[model samples]
Target: MPLGRGYLALAALATTGGLAACGREQQTYCADQNGVVVPDVRCDDGSPGYYYYTGSYGRGRRPGYRLGGGSRIASTDSNGRARAGLPSTGHVSNGHVTSGGFGSSGHGSSGG
Candidate 1:
């Protein structure tokens, strides 16, 4: 028994293969330590169980949900954008959140 070209092509098209669209980007959402997707506000206000989840496979302009991983979107935001003060990159996994985003240990910066 041998595999046909059609079957091979289909398998290749599936999963993380070369056939993936070059101009495709998905929504980089925020999740909790348990990897549960929640409202953007929760992640922004430094609420408990709040963290960023980067499941975007490729780089596309359109914003969409992650095709991989296990997560349930809590709710959609009126504005599709992460609130201010929350870093766009990096994730907090220690179950300790800082309100001022990256490099913030709940301490105010002092510099004149």
Candidate 2:
């Protein structure tokens, strides 16, 4: 039996919906205690961080910030090692801005 147009449309919709849920990218947002924005990857270790999206894979969009004195922030420490519980700072190394810190594995969440 030939499928009705309405049935076909519904089937197509269902398939699309199912496929949408299959391939998704989980998004994580990282922020400091004072609510400053940081790189999402910095929060992967479960430091002071928050979830912009906690569910299955999906398109993630995050806010952008304009650095007042350029995008790079000088590291307070000379060795390039950041304090465990501190937020990721833009450390200048070799004339480039690199993310600083080995994010803490402690349990804490901060809103951005």
With candidate 1 superimposed using the best TM-score fit, by how many Å does residue 26's alpha carbon deviate from the native? 1.8
* Cα lDDT tens digits for candidate 2, 9-106: 99999988877654433222333333344565544444433222221112332334312211111223212123222234442112122222222222
Give model 1's TM-score versus the native structure. Answer: 0.32
lDDT of 1 by residue, 50-101 (tens): 4444333333312233335412222232121234222433342212232232
Clash totals, every prediction: 2, 2
Which regions of candidate 2 deviate over 4 angstroms?
33-36, 39-112
lDDT of each: 0.37, 0.33
Distance from true location, Cα of 42 in model 2, Å = 6.5
Model 1 CA deviation exceeding 4 Å by range = 1-20, 56-112
- TM-score of each predicted structure versus truth: 0.32, 0.32
